[model samples]
Target: MPVSASYRWSPFCVDGVTTVAVKTLKENAAEVEKKDLLSELEVMKSLDPHVNVVRFLGCCTDKDPIFVIIEYVNRGKLQTYLRNSRAERHYGNTHGKSNILTSGDLTSFMYQVAKGMDYLTSRGIIHRDLAARNILITDDHTCKVADFGFARDVVTSKIYERKSEGKLPIRWMATESLYDNIFSVKSDIWSFGILMWEIVTLGSTPYPGISAADVMRKVRDGYRLEKPEHCRRELYNIMYYCWSSDSNERPTFLEVVQMLDKLLHTEMDYIELERFPDHNYYNIVNLSGEKL
Candidate 1:
């Protein structure tokens, strides 16, 4: 679960058998936001039982409290792992700390996330909030896309009105979402591109030291997040293509999956491996010894 920094909700394990996160609207905002929250909950109910997406166990709406129960992923949020890896890298370079995962581990994680997205998109559902903190990993390092609080039915018309807009994290939102006020499966693709960048950079903040407005301006000018030093050219190409200025230029989730699948299978040259010396090919090996 994400840290309770500015979050109003708190996560707790339930009955020693499940982990559930509860988000309580502020008293003043509850009356106004209840409908939207309920809408999301209903959508969750409709999409339950998918292995890639988080399960909605049940909910509670009583006199003074409202809560939704979800599957408990014990390994915590993907952001936690990314942050830990980044810290380890920093310390490892300066003080000889060990690395948690190499580049190959990152690649496997990305492949799993793409598979999850492909599954959701196939079901006609788009995960509007596809951020690092929203993805949960298992203790064995398998990924599940969680936090569907912002997800919506893809075919629903006018589900979000301009006036009803709340503050978006901005950085994670697509260019069309930020500028054209248009959102579609393509918008989710944009978020996925940023997510890929996060995986490569180990959860480095997008547009670091830049304001959201500036990011919008830069995106409008065709600027995108830069590729990290350790990233492969093929991977960078994929990310760049995903964030193309024209949404139509971006590949479909299925296409994204195919491209990543290909890259994951391609063998790296000795120079390539040495350039990313910390990367371990074994990290991509599944428990059964098959390539992921």
Candidate 2:
């Protein structure tokens, strides 16, 4: 669901065989919150459905608790799913599983996300927030881009400028986006690199132990995120391509898709999960805190 952190929601089963996710808001809720949800709904409605993008269902507005329905993803957030897979690898308990997440699976996930983003960018929609937590995994292991609350349609403007900022994604943001409030498809690509890092690292927090302010400062000073120990040089290079200091130097979503496609078709693995080092999951409850 494309909701803010304060939005309360839950999943319900239909006939005990199917499930659907619902985002509900009472009629008496603040106007800003309701407008946020409705705004996301409009963005979702503007695009054609894709296999890699979450499907939007119907909504109920003429009621006390307005409901926005969306296709339910069984595996939930990609970050949590990746973390669980890492746990399985850590404990050596990945048995009897036909679909244990492999290096290939991770590559496929990234490829799928790229394809989804490609579709969105082609439609002139910039997903201001593109990260692991905003993506969802399905029972069949397909990655779908979700949560369009921060998305904007730049079809006419070709760019989005932040008029008023409440909270911005600092760590995943591009250099221009961090330095200035400007956003574009290239900025989304920059965030994609960070998402690639999350997938390779099994949801490890980016710029671990650094404050959001420090992240902005370091990024502005030409400090890029280090490649994961298990990430291949070629894949890391692609990530570097996305994190270019100049937005114009960054690859387009289509170019990114093509690059990832080539990597996927290669016999060599780009990421080796077995080689991933053991590390504690850094949970950042507050992004504005001194340290993430």
Local accuracy by lDDT, each model: 0.69, 0.83
The lDDT leader among the candidates is 2
Pairs of residues clashing in candidate 2: none
RMSD list, candidates in order: 8.1, 2.4
What is the C-alpha lDDT profile of model 1 across 1-292, one tens digit per residue? 6432222556677778565766655666545466656766777877747666777778887755567677777777887787776567545656555546766677777778888888777666767778787888877778888766667776555223234465565777777778777777788888989888777766666776566668889988888887666676788898898898788999988898898887777675211322442332112111221101
Which residue pairs in model 1 clash with each other?
none
* lDDT accuracy of residue 160 in candidate 2: 93
Q: What is the lDDT of residue 100 in candidate 1?
A: 67
- In TM-score terms, candidate 1 sits at 0.81
Point out where model 2 deviates above 4 Å: 1-3, 13-18, 26-30, 94-99, 289-292
Cα TM-score of candidate 2: 0.91
In model 1, which regions exceed 4 Å deviation?
2-16, 26-29, 92-99, 156-162, 269-292
Q: Residues 1-292, candidate 2: write the lDDT tens digits.
A: 3345557667888789767898877446776667767877888888888999998877887865677788888888898888777777767664585445788889899999999999998888999889998999988888999988778888999799977566677788988887788999999999999999988888878888777878889889989888778889999998999999989999998998999899988899888766777663464646553211
